[model samples]
Target: MAPNRGRPKNLYQFHYGCQLFPTETRTQKQLRLALQARTQAETGPTLRRNLNRSNRSVKAAEEPTPSHPQTGTEQHDVLGFNEGPSLWEDTEEILNEEDEVSRARLRSLHQEMIEQQRHRNWKDVMACLFPAYLHFKKLTSNWTVPNPFLNLSSEVCACPVEAYKERDVDLIDLMVAAIDVYQSLKSKERKLTQEVTSTDQQDVLAQQSCPACFGVSIPNNDSTEPASEPADNHQVFICLDGNFQHRHHERASKNYIGIENQTLFVPSQDIESSNSEIREAELAKRVTKKAKDRCAEQHKAADDRRNASTWKGCDDTGLFGCCCRHDSVIAFCNIHKTGEGRGLPMSIIKRLLNSINPNVQVGVLYDIGCTLGKFFKARGLLTNHLLRLKFATAVFHSYVHDWPCQLQFNPRYNNGWGLTDGEGLERLWSYLLPLVSPLRYATRNHRISAINHRSLFHNTLGIENIVLTLKRKFIHALKTKKESEGIVHQFLQDQNPHERGQKYTVEFFRAQWQKQRKFEIEISQTNREKKAEQAQFYKRGEALKSLVETLMDSLAASPQSDPAQSLSLIQQMQELQKLQDEEAAKLGSLFVVEPGAERD
Candidate 1:
């Protein structure tokens, strides 16, 4: 083809200016030349602006809008492109079309994505695809943030979602971790707040003290003082009304007058108009004194009744029937039935009773371990007024033995007196001996010896039995005076000191003497049995010795009686027998030895 028509002046001018004075750096220019040569080689040849009218219109449509002539230089610079005006404009149009397509595609992708990337203009497009997208975003925006209690770390989030999804543990696990931290912080806050509130309330409650009786002083606004005091005796001062005060005074005045008085001693004016308050005060003092005396009498009567009512009982059927009294009445009452095993101290009993009821009469004494019937019999006799009217009627109850077999024999008693035999005698001595002696004596030397002696005496006599006897004798004395229908003094007068009389009559002594006699007879019988056993053992020993002697005599009288020959034969036999005995002894010793001993 003849040289194609040269490009139009505008197109040629554009290409010539780009090639002659390229806008790109040297490296860029070289790259562009290489790209241009590659494109030209692929296409074979090309001419500038070779287009039909339809092509021209489409190309023009692809171009970007021209910058406005009135636009400022800064606006023009911001709009600058590396390519010429037409190419730059075309690229801008393509970019604008691509953005529009992306925005349109996002609307159909997901409403959530559209909202997340809200900067793009997708509202119109999204409304077409999803009508409720905007509303959903608005409603859920506030709740979008995850709970802080949940452990929503990336690793946790990426775990096997299916495993936890059906179980609901994922959310619970998240909440649990989050809540632990939250509660720790919240608990500290709550504790601090409670402390502050409690302190405030305590301060308020501490301010007021009792206004009456002065028994309790109200706390000052800022002072720390206890609410009550024992010594305070101040009377309460109430602000009484005039009418109340008048009534009080009238009552006081009436109380002061004698019951026989029919009329006022003074004129009505003097009696009614005179300040009644002064006379009322005097009347009050007399009434208070009378009331105090009545109260004292009531207290004294109560104490007397208590003394008469307190008593215990025991039986004296055993060999050892010596009367013993416990020091503590209350302890006796508490552990009274404890017969041979553990005996309560009379002193401890007394203290405990006094502690429980201070009005208890300590002088009204009774041994805790006594037979039931004897105690009642004593009570019946001692109740008479003619026999030692000042002393209160007292009874005794017996102690029980510790061992079940002993307790079975003495069923009425419990296990408080002393142990049967001497198994736990040492323990009992350690526990009780100190209590019996004076504190000073106990603190001094020989404490252990004193305790052992007490235990031995107690064990031998059966402490419960002894305590019962003394209680019985006292009761008997009272009974004799009652039955004789005479005062205790009169009964004593009847018995002459010259007649070798007992201080107290012994109505129950026969039973005690009989028991003692039986005890002696039993002891003698036991000794006889022991002697018989010893004789039998001696007889057995003599029989064994005689049998051994008979065996030796038989051996000595054997056959072969030639003096030298028999002696030699006997010597040989003796040697043979000695050897056999030695082997047998060794075997017997070894067989008899115990396995344990062998190991040792």
Candidate 2:
């Protein structure tokens, strides 16, 4: 297209011969052209040329580049398509891809195992079996190998350790192999079933349907599917406490070595900040006072020695000290530790709660349950976990607590705890004493393992006993019910002819309620009378104070210069003391006893 002669001269033109006229005045057109020229100068051919100088510099900003440039050999490290094919590398990649697929399949199988309740520790069991499977496969290379399900235990026992060693297989390796094998078997079975079902459907479809009707009725095969297991509502009771087993450790006194060393104290998280600070200040003050007293004693002794022997060379020796060895353990479920033992039990409790099913009712019995409850309430710790928790003290421990504490933490009052449940930890300790001697001689790991194994064995036996007891109870209940039903029926038939006893009547219940109300009123009246008497009773402190004041007054009034007057004053003070002792005896007669303070 040709430019129009009638258009403004201040217009733009393209290389394709397209022309555009300016819409603004001459000054605006000039300014627009100037701006365009400046922009072009800033980001035009020169800028593009600069960026092109190093393709790497621009690309490097967008992506990572190695610090040291690669040589030809380094670049060729990874096999290229142009190079000869590497069978081993290709095989490795294929195997890795297969392994990933197998792992996913195995996870599903493991979940199935757990859901079926076939095994609690399916992975560990499989780990122990996989090496045997491998050995069997090697031996039966020319022949067909039987499935592990036939006799997995026997195979495991027969398989040599050498087979595992040859393949550099460990327990973990065995576990992985087992998973892969299970996954493969499952996939193969699934594929075969799918093929069979498909072929059967095709064959049925190929045959002519009933001429009169349109559909063929096939019997449903899904009726035999196993019923799903119910959710576990088994209640678990766990007791936690510190058991101080005195095992000698070489490094028990490592932190308590020298005279200048401060007390081997660990700041506790359970203690309030103010209380901790006060304790620290008190300890420091006591240490300072002790040091002063020691210095005074030393100086006095030195002076005495100098006076006695007419001193020689000055001796500058100060006090020397060594450390003491005594270790204390705080344990829960036979798992013990020696350290700052405050929060260790709390951590173990938290872990135990988390691992169990959320619906399980957990009753924790501790010796200091009341104190722990107060601490937990104050701090709002374990708030999320208290939903199904029942906190109680052990039966024996509860006897030592105050009335209010017993009311809150006594297991007798707690409906969640079963008979003898709270005593489990105590029973475990009794069993543990026999095995604990080994801990003194064994390594730390060995001690832990021994305790754990013994605990496990005890738990297993306890479970068996519980199961047997329940079974026996069920049988006894059935037999007793059957035996009593006939006699009860005959008795009821006989009683039907006569009126029921007055004990079952509404009047009897009304009378009982009235009697209870009267008893409660009487108790309240007694409590009120006791409280009033208590208010009139003189406190021991007040009685002592009065006696002291009277003696002070008598002493002040006496004339100190005259011996007769002083003697009389002394006799008067003695008489006052005698009177005070008699008054104290009277006050003690009305002493209110604190609960649990009575001697056993």
Candidate 3:
């Protein structure tokens, strides 16, 4: 019998395991065309039906007929052919044609399936089976060879059995080899794809030219400058806002128009002026011509100076000290430069200054707010000439006094203090009175009473209202002092003169005052404690002096003793001195007796 040359059993097998994997071979362009044709065919019939229905009479009058001779011939040939199976001929021609077509379609489908199966097998072997086989070989090679069932190709019947039996190595080494092959293949594919895509893109770009360059034609001229080098600033004038002369006119004019204002001009002679007088006159004219320009330069310079001063003073006194008299005065003026010209109130200025220098002690000699000025004036009446002279000297000595106290007093100078009201005002007054009195006059006398009076006054009557009332009252009282004196006299007369005013002479006054008054009780508890500490300190000093004398006597008497023993004695003396120092510190006194005594 002839050897069976049939397909393998695996090929005929149902493959109930799963369907064959499909391969990606269809071109995107072909699929897209097929989809478009199907959509058009479906829609065309509906469109034609609608057209015929809309014009039924016209369609009936124009009968349909074949346009070409082959159209009718083709129809007749199709109808004349055999339609069914014939017993005599042993074959149905129509059936045979149908079978042939069916066979051709089956053949095409089988080819597609085989290609898909081959691709799937290649991927599975490369990605899954090969890696697994390599891993098994690496682990098993060190031991006795494993069974032949471990051979993946033999089990899958995908690759030759001889290939499966090939010796294995480390999985990583095998994986590296596979990876190198994959990378090479992938690189080639990418290069080809990129070449095709880039070519297509370049063609597209070449076909679509730039509209501007395309619409306008210019003859080639060697005289023309290269496009990369733009026209000089004088030649090219571009008005971004669009209302201006063209490029040619712009080059001729050599001056670009500015918004609202025309291009400024300076005569060549004015620019070339060499004489000092001419230069000075030109400079003055330039400044006078544009006040804004001159003012801006001056303002910028002033700001730079102020900033330099601020940096210089930050280490010594902080930024507040850098403020100039003009700044304070301007702040005080309350003049709204940019808006409505309304001056700020004097009280507002005071609040502003206090806010700016809340922690610093500022003298009141410089302009302070009106209320503070009046308060200072009132205190000045009580102050003696000697105190005033000292105050004047102190003000001269320290430049802190030169600062504009009045302008600094404004709340506007302080960050975020302008909106403070009654409670905030009271707190500010309390804080400022103490700060001001300490630094202002340099007087030995305590201004506690004066500070308290001002604080209480501001607290009870608002600062502005108090100044207003005082002004009104002072004028009225000056005009009518006799009436005020009478009221005062009546009150004074009502009290007994002996009880109202008691006079004491020196010697007898001291005896009576000392005897009648409880002086000891008047002494502070802290003072009593200090006195006790002094007594204890004296006792400790006596004890320490005795101990030191004994140590010195011992050392002098034992001069022949071992030097080491003598040194040890001296160390003990030093330790005692240290103990004395620690004790003295507890009592708030230095242990040293002499002012410049050397401590050992």
Candidate 4:
């Protein structure tokens, strides 16, 4: 290309100098500058002028600047390429405008990214909902109405969407299908009801019962009287307890027709100024007395309530009724906290008792047997059925009670309970908690609905009955004479057995029980002796005081009393005083107190 005439002359001149004396070749620019200055000082005006010219030339070659023909402002360019304009030469207004545009572009891009991410999240949610709905549909397919989805909109079928987009008809159909399925599988009479009503409906004809379902073949309640058995055989044993569910956030109570009916009173937060001094004093006295009385009553009730137990940290009470006979939950209620004792569980127990035959002995087992026992005994409601009623404590809970209580109420002593204890209720709660935990935060109605459905499903589904049926079949198969003979032959085929048969008879258990009773008796005697020893000290002190009083009375009557009698009285008094001093010293040392302070 031809050299441009408009280009700066210094640009070509600087290039020529760079070719001659390369700027980077010099180790130190400062050294070069110093040498030029020294030569300038030694030489004449011509040499000084040349050195000054060279110094300017070298600096220009090291960091050369190019400028536009129109604007004289120095500029930096990439190689020989010319950009439109430099910020150094541009006006401040133009620079500010560019910066503002850049920020706006950045913000727009950021918003677009966020929108894309949100759309992706919505799609994922819809995908999950579709599979869940399909699962529900599959579960209810057997009982669902014909062509439940026939009336669906094309848009609904086109893609997975949010629940709100579905037509009301579809939602209603889904709900109806769910209800139908539940009803089909559920027992005709809810939990133990058929048996309860069998007595009243004796006129009804006997019908074949389905083996796969939880049903009874008997129709007449007249035969409801349990077959005569040993006193140790019980028709049923039920365990009861309460479970409390916690809330993440507290909400104000909603008006409902359920059990929680007590009106709660909250103290006023706002305080008002009082004018009368005498009135305030009297009011304060009354308040203090009322508070003290309330505290005393609460403490007494707390001590009494140990006979029954409630779930820890749970304010809401679940009065569970578990049948130890069947190892299943028979009935449960979400009970309101009525009073100190387990009023709800007790009521439920009575209801359960009424459902069964009056002649059938029923044993009740619970965590708090002591409290329930006292309540049941004192209520007079069960006085007529007292002979049929037996109460015992759960094995796991017996250890927490006093030794006397353990001996009386422990399941080990209750032969009627047999092998299975009352812990069936505890196991039921464990299975139920995980299923209901997620629904807890929902409305109370929703939470209760879910729990009721699960409980009912477990009861009517025949899971236990199916297992029982299989067990009976297996036993029948094994009971055949051929099978029994074959098994016996197989067993005898072996020359020797690795393990021997172990058997424990009633006599063995009876002997063990006798030994246990004797030990318990010895323990009681020891306890009584220890208590008597404590009482003896107090009794001696009291006797000495009485003697001293009598002696003084005699001395008053006869001023010249006998010295020996007087001395004896003094010695007794001294002994009593010494005993009191020793007791006080022991008490002071055992308990925390201020240093040097007398216990009395």
1-600: candidate 3 lDDT, tens digit per residue: 222235332322222223444453334346777999999999999999888887997877897778864546555555654455433342212334555565556655666576455444455445555445445555667335646345344333676545656566789855744643454333334344446654332222111211111112233455675535322111100000000000011112211211111001112132123123333543654533132222123232223344443333121111011111111111111110111100122222233333231222222222122222332233332122212210111122123221232123333223322121112222333344444523223211112223223333333344334446447656775766678667655654453444446333345444654554455546665776677776776776666676677667877898676777657766766765676666677676454455686643
Task: List model 2 lDDT by residue over 470-499, tens digit each.
Answer: 576568768876886766555444432234
Question: 495, model 4: CA deviation in Å?
Answer: 31
Per-prediction TM-score: 0.13, 0.35, 0.14, 0.41
Query: Which ranges in model 2 have alpha carbons more than 4 Å from their true place?
Result: 1-234, 246-248, 251-342, 471-600
| Regions of candidate 1 where Cα sits further than 4 Å from its true position | 1-423, 428-534, 537-600
TM-score of 1: 0.13
TM-score of 4: 0.41
Residue-wise C-alpha lDDT for candidate 1, range 140-213, written one tens digit per residue: 57337454233433322456655565443567645633532333333334344446654332222111111111
* Residue 412 in model 2: lDDT: 69
Give the clashing residue pairs of candidate 2, or none.
Answer: none
Q: Order of all candidates by lDDT, from best down to worst?
A: 4, 2, 3, 1
- Lowest summed lDDT across 10 adjacent residues in model 3 is found at 236-245
Better of 1 and 4 by TM-score: 4
List of clashing residue pairs for candidate 4: 199-221, 244-314, 307-371
Q: lDDT (CA) for every model shown?
A: 0.32, 0.45, 0.35, 0.50
Indicate whether candidate 1 or candidate 3 has the larger TM-score.
3
Arrange candidates by TM-score, descending. Answer: 4, 2, 3, 1
